[model samples]
Target: MTQADDLADEERRLRQLRLVVDITAQILAEDRHLTLCEALRLIEAARTTAGRLFPGRQDTFDLVVRPRLERIVLERFGIVSTAPVN
Candidate 1:
């Protein structure tokens, strides 16, 4: 693939990541019945989806996205240790 093709593909993947993360955040914020365990599972699913969308970018996601998600979980569910996610 050409350089432009690679860039376009990366952009598309980034958009997908954003969509997944945004939707997950919405669920976490709006789902009043969501338990802490369920919220954590949703975050894990988002992380896994992110890893599939951008291989070898776990650290990037941890730095850029995980904290936000963690904060939301903390706020919604109260104090909980952040666990390693696959």
Candidate 2:
């Protein structure tokens, strides 16, 4: 592929990654009570797409997706404290 084509592909992948992250954040913010299955499904989809778009870069998927999902799950289940102070 030409340089321009490669740049376009990269840009598109970046956009997709952003979308996935945003959606995951939205889901977590809207309903912290997401079930395990629901979280897995979302994570799996993001992982698959990320892996395909950026092969050999598992850290991108792990870093961008897994941490957020884990954080949300932990916060939702009270594994991590988010207590409010008055």
Candidate 3:
């Protein structure tokens, strides 16, 4: 659309990104004993909240945060998924 509209959208997306990062950091800090299932649930809740708060911001959060978080989870817990080790 117009330049002003584009700028507003960018600003809104940035604000949502910051919120998501802050929430994730808090969750990661507080939930040291989380199981894999619990970690997945936390990620899902973060995604849901991001979508509900910003509607079309899911893509932004997913693109920016999901991969990094996945890496952190894997590294922190030494998680390695293999196919039955057969």
RMSD (Å) of each candidate, 1 decimal = 4.3, 5.0, 4.7
Which residue pairs show collisions in model 1?
A: none
lDDT of 1 by residue, 1-86 (tens): 99999999999999999999999999998899999899989989999999999888888989999889888988887776667665
Tens digit of per-residue lDDT, candidate 2, span 1-86: 99999999999998987887788767865675777678767777777777888898878778667877767766665575465633
Query: Which residues of candidate 3, in runs, are more than 4 Å off?
Result: 1-17, 81-86
Give a tens-digit lDDT track for model 3, residues 1-86.
Answer: 99999899879876876777677766664677877777777777778877876787789878877766766667667888552543
Q: What are the runs in model 1 whose C-alpha is more than 4 Å off?
A: 80-86
The TM-score of predicted model 2 comes to 0.73
Q: What is the lDDT of residue 62 in candidate 3?
A: 87
Worst 10 residues of 2 by lDDT: 77-86
**For model 3, what is the alpha-carbon lDDT of residue 18?**
70
RMSD score of candidate 1 (Å): 4.3
TM-score per candidate, in order? 0.87, 0.73, 0.61
